[model samples]
Target: MNEFLLIFRRDFTTAADQPSAESLQQHYRAWKEWFENLAAQDRLVGPTKRWDGAGKVVRNAKDVTDGPYADIKESIGGMLIIKANDYDEAAEVAKDCPIFAFGGNVEIRKALS
Candidate 1:
C-alpha cells in the first residue's frame, strides 16, 4: 500500500468576528472522530499536526516574508498521513474527512517512499 499525506486547510480563526463556541466544539468533535476512525483501521501513519499560517517562505536560498502561500488558500490548518492502496483508495479515505462538512478542504498527495 502507498502512503498519502492529507493536508487539511481551513480558516480556523475566521469565525472570530462572530464566534460560536458550540459550533467550534462540534467541528472539533467531528475532527476527532475522523482521526479515531483512521487509527482504528491502522491506516494512520504519523501524528497529525496543525500548521501555523504566519511564516516566512524560503525558495532558492531566498527568503520572502509572506502571509500566505500562493499554492493554497485559507492556509494549512492541519494534516494527516495515511496508508492506502492507491490514489483512488486514498481519495475514498479522504471522503470521510471532516473538513468537507465544515466548509474546508483536504488535499491528498502521495507520500514519497
Candidate 2:
C-alpha cells in the first residue's frame, strides 16, 4: 500500500463563519469516529495535525510576511496521512470526510518517498 495525504481546507475567518459549540462538538465526534474506523482497518499512516491558520511566509532573502494568504477564499486547516492502494482509493476514503458538512474540501495526494 502507498501513503496518501489528506489536506483539509476551510473558509472560516470571521465570527459569522464559526460553527456553534454543539456543531463543533458534533464535528469532532464525527472526525474521531472516522479516524477510529481507519485505525481499525489499519489504514491510518501517521498522526493528524491541526493548524492554527497562522504562519509566516518567506518570499526572498530578507522579505517575510504573515500568512495564510488572507485574500484567498479558503485556508488549509489540517492534514492526515493514510495508507491506500492508490489515488482513487485514497480519494474514496476521503469522500466521507466531515469537512464537507461545513463547506470545506479535502485534497488527496499520494505521498512521495
Candidate 3:
C-alpha cells in the first residue's frame, strides 16, 4: 500500500462563527469517530495535525510574508497521512471527511518516499 496525505482546507475567518456548543460537540464527535475508524482499519499513518491558521511564508532566502495567502477563500486547517492502495482509494477514503460538513475540502495527494 502507498501513503497518502489528506490536507484539509477550510475558511478560518468563519471559525468563530461556529454553531452552538452542542453542535460543536457533535462535530467533534464525528471527527473522533472518523479518526477512530481509520485507526481500527490500520490505515492511519500518524496523528492528525491541526493548524492555528496563522503563520509566515518564506518567499525567498530572506523575503517572508504572512501565510495561507490571506486573499484566498480557504486555508489549510489540518492534515492526516494514511495508507491506501492508490490515489483513487485514498480519495474515496477522504470522501467522508468531517470537513465537508463545514463546506471544506480535502486535498488528496500521494506521499513520496
Candidate 4:
C-alpha cells in the first residue's frame, strides 16, 4: 500500500465563521467515529493531531510571521496519513471525511518515499 497525506482545510478566521458549540461537538464526534473506523480497517497510518488555528509562519531566518492565514479564506485545519493502493483509492477514502459537512475539503497527496 502507498502512503498518502490527507490535508484538511477549513475556515475559522472570525467569530462569525466559527460553528456553534453544539455543531462543533457533533463534528468532533463524527471525526472520532470516522477515525476509529479507519483505524479498525488498518487504513490509518497516523490520524495525527488537529492543527491549531492560531499559529505562525516561518518563511526564512528572521522572517517568521503570524498565520491565522488571514490572507486566505481557508487554512489547513489538520492532517492524517493513510495507506492506499493509489491516488484513486486515497480519494475514495477521503470522500467520507467529516470536513465536507462543514463546507471544508481534503487534499490527498502521495507521500514521497
Candidate 5:
C-alpha cells in the first residue's frame, strides 16, 4: 500500500459563509465521524487542521513579513495523511471531505519516500 498526502485547499471566506453555528457543529461532527471510521479501518495516518494564521513563505535569506496569507483566495485549509492501497482508494477517501459541500477542492499528492 502507498501513502498519499491529501492536501485540502478551499476558499476560507466561502466556506465560512455557508453554514450557521449549528450547521457547522453538524459538519464538525461528521468530520470527526469520518476520521474515526478511517481510523477504525486503519486507513488514516493522521488528519490535521492548521491554524489560518500560521502561513509563512520565506524568499531567499531575507524574512519578508507580508502576512500569514489566509487572505488569499485559495488558501490551504488543512490536510490528511492517509495510507491507502492506491490513488483510487485515496480518491474514495477524499470523497467525504467536508469542503466538498462548499464546492472547495482537494488535491492528492504522492509522497516521496
Candidate 6:
C-alpha cells in the first residue's frame, strides 16, 4: 500500500464569509464520522491534526511575519495521511471527504518512499 496526504482547504476568511456556529458544528460532526469510517476501513495512517488560524512565515533566514496568508482567501483547515493502493484508489477515497459539503477541497498527494 502507498501513503497519501490529504490536505483540507476551506474558506472561512471574513466574518461575513464564515459559516454559522451551528453549521460549523454540523461540519465537525461530519469530519468525525469520516475519520471513524476511514479508521474502520484500516486506511488511516499516522496522526491527524487541525491547524489554528494563527501562522508565521519565515523568509531568507532573516525576515519573519505572521499570517494565514493575505494572498489566498482559503485556509488549510487540517491534514491527515491515509493508505491506498494507488493514485486512483486515493482519489476514490478522497471523493467521500466532507470538505466538499462546505465548498472546500481535498488535495491528495502520494507520499514518496
* TM-scores for the candidates: 0.82, 0.91, 0.88, 0.90, 0.80, 0.91
- Pitting candidate 1 against candidate 5, the one with the higher TM-score is 1
Steric collisions counted per model:
0, 0, 0, 0, 0, 0
Task: Report RMSD for candidate 4.
Answer: 1.6
Global lDDT of each model?
Answer: 0.80, 0.89, 0.87, 0.89, 0.76, 0.88
lDDT of 4: 0.89
Q: Could you tell me how far off, in angstroms, the CA of residue 19 lies in candidate 2 after the best superposition? A: 0.8
Instruction: Compute the lDDT for candidate 1.
Output: 0.80
Across 1-111, the per-residue lDDT of candidate 6 in tens digits comes to 999999889888777777889998998999999999999999999767888977977779987888666578888888989999999999999999999988899899999
* Residue 22 lDDT in candidate 6: 98
Model 2 lDDT tens row, 3-92: 998999998867898999999999999999998999999998877777888877676778778786656778898999999999989999
lDDT-better candidate, 1 vs 3: 3
Q: Alpha-carbon error at 34 in model 5, in Å? A: 0.8
Q: What TM-score, to 2 decimals, does candidate 1 have?
A: 0.82
The regions of model 3 sitting more than 4 angstroms off are 14-17
Q: What is the C-alpha RMSD of each candidate to the true structure, in Å?
A: 2.6, 1.4, 1.9, 1.6, 2.6, 1.3
Worst 10 residues of 4 by lDDT: 62-71
Put down candidate 4 lDDT per residue, 1-113, tens digits, no spaces: 99999999987657877789999999999999999989988999954698887887776677778885657888999999999999999999999999998889999999888
As for candidate 6, its clashing pairs are none
> What shift in Å separates residue 63 of candidate 6 from its native position after superposition?
1.8
- Please list the residue runs of candidate 4 whose C-alpha ends up more than 4 Å from where it truly belongs after superposition: none
Q: For candidate 6, what is the lDDT? A: 0.88
What are the runs in model 5 whose C-alpha is more than 4 Å off?
14-18, 47-50, 67-72
lDDT of 5 by residue, 1-113 (tens): 78899887666565445678887798788778888888898988755565463567666878665555634776676788888888999999899877787567889987777
